[model samples]
Target: MIMMDEIVLFNPGDSIGNFHDYHEAVQTAQIYQERHTESGHVVVVKSDNGAPSFDIFLAEQQLDNGQKNPSTSKRYTISKKL
Candidate 1:
């Protein structure tokens, strides 16, 4: 039997953070996306031994000044993994 480890990497363009759990990393990424206008992403990698890992990419939209014209802020989840 073989065991595979899952690694989650949070990329906010300029910096990167690592997480052991997928949901926690995604949650943190969402928080960052809501707090800043800059675009950010999360990558999940699953691997075993020294073999190449499979990656899943998720990204958030970049908010602009014009999009904030409304009185209330909009909250939604926008992510795609491949």
Candidate 2:
């Protein structure tokens, strides 16, 4: 088992792209989120076989009246092919 750092960018519709560099992965995620006006995140996994890769979801911002609005957040993952 080889240990490595993997970066994953999650896009809308459950699409994902894997990156070897953390900076590139985060940059890509930010660009995509800004363009789509949605919430997304970049995750780093360190381990052998890269077990337990997942998405970081942010909840919708609350209104002034303390009401939770719907979030446009989406889930992303790293592809095994990477």
Candidate 3:
């Protein structure tokens, strides 16, 4: 399993643009999915490395009961440093 540190940090409601390579795209996707695997107050993943990836809304759940609230579709846009 890939470690959390290895996965790039993403936020909700971010926009993604063109991707440079397929590996970057795949990595972004993997991290996006991982963020949703857990319950309760999850953060969406976004990559601005110009990598093609999916944008999923992370829903926050009750810490004690694990009940998730309605997920708000937040856009995540990642940017690269030129």
Candidate 4:
């Protein structure tokens, strides 16, 4: 299983597809997962420590205004919208 901590950020949109942001991105991936799952297919792969890799745990919708930039504050939580 790919470690969310490692790094993975592959946008579902392909070269022929249009651009999409975080929310759209997640929805798209989930949609694909649902389809594959319904078809009795399992898509499991390893995450890479590169641009195409991101922490899903961290990727989850979490507002973090309290979490200041490392350049500004050292330790703090983000003021995310509930």
- Cα RMSD of predicted structure 2: 11.0
User: How many clashes in candidate 1?
Assistant: 0
- Name the lDDT of candidate 4: 0.29
Model 4 residue 58 lDDT? 25
Candidate 2 lDDT over 8-77, as tens digits, reads 3222333344456655655665665667564533333221235433332222221223224324322233
Ranking by lDDT: 1, 3, 2, 4
Q: Which stretches of candidate 3 lie over 4 Å from their true place?
A: 1-17, 38-82
- Model 1: worst 10 consecutive residues (lDDT sum): 73-82
Give per-residue CA lDDT, model 3, range 9-82, as digits (tens): 33333333224464565455456556645533333334444555444333331122222432432233422211
lDDT of each: 0.39, 0.37, 0.37, 0.29
At residue 3, what lDDT does model 1 achieve? 55
Q: Candidate 4 residues 2-70, lDDT tens each?
A: 733322222232111121243443444456556555433222222332333211222232224454432
The TM-score obtained by model 1 is: 0.34
Candidate 4 wrong stretches, greater than 4 Å: 1-5, 8-19, 38-82
What is the Cα-based lDDT of residue 62 in candidate 3?
12
Which candidate leads in lDDT? 1
The TM-score between candidate 4 and the true structure equals 0.28
Location of the lowest summed lDDT over 10 successive residues in candidate 2? 55-64
Judging by lDDT, tell me the better candidate of 1 and 4.
1
Q: Please give the lDDT score at residue 46 for candidate 2.
A: 24
